[model samples]
Target: MTDVESSPLGSERERIAAYPLAEAIPEDRLNAELAALERMDEKPLPLRIPGYFRLGGPGFMGAAATLGAGTLTAAMLSGAQFGYKTLWVSLVAMGSGIFMMLAMARFTAKGQTPVIQLQQREHGWFMAKVLTAFLGLVCVATVFNFGQVALGTELVESISAGLGVDWPREWNWPIYGLITSWVALSYGRGGRGVYYVECFMKLCLLAMLLCFAACLIVVGIDWGAALKGLFVPWLPRGAQGIDLFIASSAAAIGVMDWVFFNYAGLSKGWGPRHERLARADVYIGFALPFLLISFMVICVFAGTLHSAGDVPTTAIGLSKALVPLLGETGAKYAFLFGFLMVPLTTTVAMSIVCAIGLHEIFGWRPDVRSWRWKTCILLPQIALLGAWLPSPVLIIIVIAAMLSLTNNIVGWSFFLLLNDKKVMGENRSKSWGWNVGILVQVTMLNSVALMWVLNRMGLWG
Candidate 1:
């Protein structure tokens, strides 16, 4: 890659507001900043297994955020409904996430302006503000975070059941609200925010992966069907097709995941030289764990729940389906523990994403310790309260649907940025692989969302 300092892409003035503090830094200080970036970049990439593991964070956060309660619920439902036939969805989802993340990382490495600012500066689309500020905050951080709250509460109740204690269902809301609030407040400083959350998510992902993998082994999965599901795409007949569409969309990391990953990379001080490390982070830290845990969820569900013909309407219900395979307390408690960790990580991870998005949008100092912490970071919780009320199943479904739409908008917008000379610089153009991959993302996410919308509008009939 050409050095960002020498790249004759957008002028310094043109890259204004690329970061929260970029515009105000004087010109000579620009060189000092770039020099510091170069100093960090000069550090050699990690070559060993332990080295790569040590170098990872952003992808762990991305994986943690992607495997939220809704995603767990959706994966389980797919397993319970269609069995291993939909394993391809998890692969496809991870593939799309890597693709979108590549473009965002390239933008981070090459452009002086952040992707969200670049979005707003785009003349016609006018998407940056909505994609980051509105959707990142409202649709993603708030609306979806609400579902995590509900899922967290449900898991709490499920754990209560497993313990043979009749915890009142009425207390789930306030109890979870307080617990998640405490979790959110723990990120008191910016660097500490990223490190604490990343370490926490790594533990959660490892625990979830190990627990489910062990369970799936105990159940003796059909490798033939599992391989086929990974390589081949199959949807059940009729209305199930629509469900497959949504499940597939949800399985992929959406707009919020993309934004969070890029910002997380920035949080780690990643620049052009760390580009390959970034990809490794996504593949190892995010995609592997995401697909492994996801496939395990699907397989375990397919073996027990689908075979038994039980429909799971909630996260707890899905956990309870594990009872026959592993016995009551083992199944529910194991599932409950993992389920609680997934949404809890999401609640904490997305708050940082919200904070970062707000920082980019409002030019706040990128410090999590200041008033910016209150507005940029913590403000979304108020909106998240909407998920706590008696949200109709339809409302939750609508939020998930809107996320699919937001993923499309952000994905397609970044695809264009991959080609924008001003944004990505000359040597920073996208490869044919990334180009084809993004085309697939735009086609898959947008077409499915459009089909769902058309079906709801009676146009598909």
Candidate 2:
């Protein structure tokens, strides 16, 4: 990796730093898109709505990446331990994140500069490096990979055993690495490959939602309580409560979520004309799917395992807990298949984020064919050892809490950049409501982190 302060930019890397990622798009296609945007202004509302919907890709990829093990463990534990009490955490956390997500969209579309470069120019070199290394390398590429690998390997192993094939559990990581690396490395090959990758993410998001919703239906829930839990705010007491709250909220939106959504937009070459389309993508592709999955997962466990004496901590154990409730074979497989999608889809999306982030951090022009890109994308494969690791629940919660605490730094940096007049010019946000939303997000993040600390120290709960 090139040192940001010490290294001088070569011509090719300098060009990459100055322009929008659209510069990498084929000239004819880029021209065609610009022309289409021009004609889109003349089209009526009904016609443009469909076009906006079709333009969604980045949001779903973000959804896929964050919807992995951290989310699953948080939701599962929340439902089982607290019933519907922590439901509002998911809503507020994700809602608060929207402010930052929209801020990123506007900045990327209007500025057309990569976020890392923008950070360096506006915030100084050290702050930029901290955000890049922590958010990009540590959060996504390291800590987050632990849970995804552990849960993913367990689900695959369990599924195979259920089918009467007894593969050795020790080799699970190597097999998983081969399969996921092939799929992730296939990205950026061409237009069709990118489209297929987008479709695959969409399918994974849809399937995960459907499977969890089915399980929720089987166990059945208290609609009135669920609604109250979701809309009403009630904070649970003690260290465990604080930890769950932090985990659920942070998992919804954290360092990785911001990096993935921002870079994915750049990768898709979105510009000023795609601004509205980007907002629609956040609500439709990312927010809607994420909220539904989290809600249903919590509701399912609340109904089935809330009072079940002992709740399972492992993925396989959780699926098996649903067996009596769902009926033999039908219950475990349905839940396992849906649960399987969580890690599988997440690993693919996170690999892409890692690739983009490393390139930006090292000041290299991103190329799908580059050896560095290939190596970075496959870095999470080392996490397959998570198969034999301890409880994913603990691993995921620790990762989320760590990110939530550090999120203060990254969130503030983005907030500053978004409101900078020199950087955004007239495109800078003027909305007071958006500013308040971001302030609330930062406050909530720090408060939860603080609460966890106090509770751990036995000073407060």
Candidate 3:
């Protein structure tokens, strides 16, 4: 037969050309298979549900809770010592936190793995595995979870005393433990339970804000000065024990928040489709803390602590400063509530992230419903609680250092994943996005390391 007669015609030849080999398959079927393959390759990946909607009522609540303890400590310290002058730090932290969270959410939604898992995957399993183990050790050694619980318990005790209610120290440990355990258990059921905890936390945060606002209004502070403090940048002279402050501030803006938020984003099932929603979630989460902290610094500055020659070194001390303006009883309750809520929320959030890390490493199901997971998560904190005393400042310093050290490692991992062709396929991070993220992380890490080295050299006090 002639070649034209024996071979496929124009339409059939076109169809046949689509398949790997034209001889084996019918031309029309080959064309269909080729079309199918093209469609498969072109199809968009599954969209992650918006975390804000998926988190239901708990989305903002979780952010408020996460911001509670560290924000309080930072705000209180800033207000007591530097007055409102250091409010910029909180603003910077919150702003940076928002960006970091956005990136983290993107990674979680896209990668379907926690930061540690992504780290191991990108950096080599051995390196990533070692880093994860080291992180767990850091979490344990720093008493990151227990410290928050202890701080909360102590605040509760102080508030009780001020309100003429006595709570024994022995009772504090068990009570704090139980409360934290409850929080951890609450999350075991999935996003709703965590959201519930967050809602409760938001209420506490709102109450604290109201109290601070009232104090600010009553004290009659100069708005112009407060504005300047919030906007202007200045480092105080002869500031003692402020290196930890700077480090903590840097950490707040660095990797831990990103790491934690990404895990939360994943748990909430956010993806590229929910990018805007993720941004919104971060804005709400970040703004609440920023506002609370800024107001707190202003309240302390405009009200009682600014003129108090010797600044308060602890939450107890800062709370006492409020008595002159808010009345002893009012000040006491405000401080009590503020102190209790901060640590309670922070500890719970930290525990959840820690559990996530363990789950990824060991292939343990972090089903949030499993009793086994809950116990595994709580065990480290329990041990820490038993080993450490209630020293919030010390705890903050150590945690800050640990966070500083690891910030780059985590940040770089996210940066790499976002740019990875395999993980993100065609939807990788843009050049501008990569540059900004990398710059922020590298600057923060280097700055922290430099400060640490200087501190060790006795060049900074």
Candidate 4:
């Protein structure tokens, strides 16, 4: 097997010609992107960065979907408890996850096939159906929405409180639900709609980064210690430390993230010409934003709440904690607003995932304008019920257990597809380095999942 960088493809035109664009992508649009890539490739390395960076979208969407309640909570908990010791976990997890995404990007671009179709054809109907049903519909549509909406409601309440409003928390869900549903339903409208959704996601990402960065600056970071923690891998002794490490690591990537990213690219008419752009998208658009945001979150908590012995796990708790500890309402508001973007952005991305899942399950092409597509995208609205009803803790626990066990199995399936000559053709990964990266991701995810199982069973923890 030859290295990807040194593959014997001979020329850029030949490489792209070998793997033509799939019909899902508009040929005219892909041709334009290919022409752009050719122009960029002729320039110096420094000149190409801007072109690559400008073309990224799907990666940002993946980052948005994965950056919701789970990531924020894990980063908050890690900083509050370990005080920068577990900071490396987020980096490692996201880095590893980025490798998997890069693989998916390569496969999707060169093969120009939707992941669900490839799975059904290469793996089998049973695995394909089960993955879309349980992994996509159940976990993403139901369980994930419940968590994101609940968090979105809380964030809205906190933002309202910070602004000196007397808005009732009880009414927050409907408002948040309506806003998110409108934003989510806007996707797949047309090229412009997809562009708008991507722009909105980019804005949210920038807002989050700025808000958190401002908070960290106001709180005053211990750069020496934080840098050490960022570079050095360390986990505290005992079960709690291990659990935090695993949570932060595992939360960066998931089945939903994978599905959303691949379809998001396809929706943009990406083909083999977009391969490098896809990698740039993941590394810059996804990995960089995720790492920076999680890092800032951990730093903010580490500075203020680490030794307080009363670290709050929820965003509400942390937002409330910020006011007194920092003695500045602006700082508190900044943190609240920044963190609020998490669930808001995640809800939109997850809605897309569920909608895509619905289309894939029925072997139908995605049509954002269709009643079925619009209906599926609104599935997250059901999560508004979470605002009134108590969070089903036992049910969440059961779902978490199930996802932990099955998530890695899905990773293995992707690995097989990536390696399958029949599916990938000339695009089949030949690099030992790439395979090793995937192996690490699959193995680490499996280990973390098993650890979760043991924790649930009262065996390991």
Candidate 5:
């Protein structure tokens, strides 16, 4: 296990001082090292799924972080209400997401600097701080963290009931929050091993994947119909299609997704040689598993709720919908446990991601081993006491609108950075791949956001 700090570019603290990571090492110096590696390993990276999974980290971390309860709820609802109609959005999201990740990977692979640092260097500090860093880490992720903890608390209550524990309802969320805060701590500053978060994410993703698969099998899906739904894109009349489109596109790639993966690459000590690993992380780790799990989840609900002619509006409703197939107690605990896993993984992973960004923004050490990062991870626990309290609809809407606006700005800004020769240097692929990616991200994100605004004004879907 090579130390990430053991770079030729001085010590780890020195790298932190030269924030945005790339600035720490001279371009020519890093370039020479990459050239040497390329010369030593002549052949292209082969498609080795198993080996890649073992090596990949950021993508899996992204998968775990991105596909939180929101994504699951959306997929289940989509299937429950419209059967396979919105399945095509998943395909589009995945396609758009892969290219978006690869575009960022190009930045990490070449710049060796995190995107935040690049934004600061190329544009200015305000752009980096207020727009990208603050909005992403604090405004966006932090706000969402409250809802996840609240959901985690709810799941804990359900799990307790299933276990026949007579715990007080009022204490459930606080207790669950405290327990999960500890879980997040284990993977924080004092954790063992470098790849723990990635490994943990993969484990959670695998578990969730298995849970969904088992649920699907128990319900018995219509494979022929599912396949067609997958290939054929469908849009419901009115605001539903636009709303799903926005959610799907946002799910495909968001501020946290972009920031997390780029930072994850840095944390993994990825260099030019590890570019293949980065791609593998995005395509194999994040995209493949994310889509598979989502498809399975959708299929499970579609098989049952579609025939039942009922829609599940809440997570519990979605979970209980499986009762007919898995029997009362079996289905109750199955989806309950499955949904429980979603927020736990996101909580831990997002905490680390938040720590990463906060450190960069506040000029703290980038190392997760630092207490600063650990404390940052735990700060969200404060929201647990107030977790069950109702968040204002207008407040939620305002935060979401801000997030969408910031995300669109970040997507376009980074896409421009990806093309900037000064930033990416000769490392830029400048290929059609990233070109198409930025287009997909921009179109979907902006159009959906616009529709949401219009729908709010009762103007359009």
Candidate 6:
């Protein structure tokens, strides 16, 4: 055979030809041939994974979504009522979230397995099943979580009507849900799709941040007071301040987002080699909420709304606060854009999380086209839509409580596996890393659990 004929492609062709006429080519061979054909038709390129931090794509899309309706609501409420004092809660939440997520990413990257699968391996079938059930509940709760955004969007539209601009509310929830589903479906398609959605989310967040910052600048608020509000953590005089702090804290350490974020990292096939990039991605994601949403929103409210005693219960309320500082046109547009992005991306993230959870629970293969998987995800959301009018504040509080109760379950599962010599082997968390992570998880769980109990008892109010 000539040199070209004796090449790997030629050898593969020879093997296929040698098979019995009636016999089918092996699946592996068929896949190889198809891959070869694809390569032949395309230019030779370096290996690159899209939406992978090390490869130059953002890794914060999931977290950004987590910071959506719930976060925005919390920030608006905190700022309007407590001004910069509550800003510290957001900062603390962001800091805590960053640390936990970094550990999550590292665990996934080093283990090279989905978090659910890791739980299954380390904890056995029964525990795995229980974990799956827990996750499934969380997934169901996520629909409510996504519903917050949809409801928020509708509220924004309602508010805008006073400005003579009417956004249609016909089938609003379904339309928003579908749009959110589509964005998520696109992410499942590959890295390029995720990159597009993440970019769009960032743009929306940036606009809101800029508008809030501009208003703060124009209002000429006391820099000293604003700075003091951020750094000086003080509890309000009444029980309400403590309740608000707990609520805001819960919003910040939102459990579902962390679970979803780690899974996204695994879906992208991030490994130890990408550790630095993953860390950077987590930092960037954490900063978006801390600097943009928390700081800027607080400044806007502290400078204008607090001074006027105009506390906002929703994004629209905050927008009204902005109107005086930024004019009606700017405030309306900024709030509209921010409101839309928050729900849209959140719905997308929740959809994907639900889909992934279903796949894990039932051993359903990860095929986007699988009717079983799609139904598993879509059905729950449909039920949520029929259940109630979406309540952003209520959903945020519920999510926080749910996460607080379950965080220990998942966190302990992971921590044990990371430390177990048989599971992680040489990949175990370092001594200092383990100590810090354990301390943080234990502290957070206790704090959140206490708050949850207090709220349940109606003592928090």
Estimate, for each residue in 357-414, the C-alpha lDDT of model 1 and write its tens digit: 6666665566554665656556546534533474444655566566557767777777
Compared with the true structure, what per-residue lDDT tens digits does model 3 show for residues 326-383? 6644544664565566666666666665666566667564665567577666764663
**Tens-digit lDDT track of model 5 for 113-205:** 778888888877876777777777766566666667767777777678768986543677766676566666655232233365567778888
- How many clashes would you count in candidate 1? 0
Candidate 6 residue 401 Cα shift, in angstroms, is 4.7
State candidate 4's TM-score.
Answer: 0.91
- Runs of candidate 3 with Cα error greater than 4 angstroms are 1-70, 132-142, 238-248, 328-331, 383-402, 431-434, 449-459
What is the lDDT, from 0 to 100, of the residue 8 in candidate 3?
Answer: 26
Error of 5 at 107 (Å): 1.7
Error of 1 at 133 (Å): 2.6
Model 3: per-residue Cα lDDT at residue 263: 57
Report RMSD (Å) for each prediction in the order shown.
4.9, 5.4, 11.4, 4.1, 4.9, 8.4
> lDDT (CA) for every model shown?
0.68, 0.73, 0.56, 0.76, 0.70, 0.58
For residues 263-337, what per-residue lDDT tens digits would candidate 4 score against the true structure?
788777666667888888888888989999999999988998899877677756765776577665577777778
| Stretch of 10 with least lDDT, candidate 6 | 16-25
**Hey, what RMSD does candidate 2 come out at?**
5.4
**Clash number for candidate 4:** 0
Per-residue alpha-carbon lDDT of candidate 2 for residues 1-461, written as tens digits (9 for 90 to 100)? 42222223332234234433434556566457657766776898777766655668878888888788868888888888778877998888889888888887786566667777788888876666666554544455655676777777877778788889876557667777776788888777665456567788888888888888777767788999999999999877656666778767756776667767767776676666667777878887788888889899889888888878878875557766765677653655778889988988888887777777667667777777789889988876767767776645455455545555567877788888888988877788899999999878878876776665555456764
Best-first order by TM-score: 4, 2, 5, 1, 6, 3
In model 6, what lDDT does residue 208 have? Answer: 59
Worst 10 residues of 1 by lDDT: 16-25
As a whole number from 0 to 100, the lDDT of residue 296 in candidate 3 is 62
> What is the C-alpha lDDT profile of model 6 across 1-461, one tens digit per residue?
63324433243334333212101224463344344434533543232222223232234565556566656777777777766776677677666666567666666556555667777876875445454434434444454554554555565455557568776454445566666566666654432454566565566556656755665566556667777877888768766776676667765654455566666655444444445556656666545544566677666667667756646666655665566566555564555555566666666666666776766667666765567656655644553343245444455555445556566666666667767777666767777865576658546754765686577568665
C-alpha lDDT of candidate 5 relative to the true structure: 0.70
Give per-residue lDDT, candidate 1, residue 250.
51
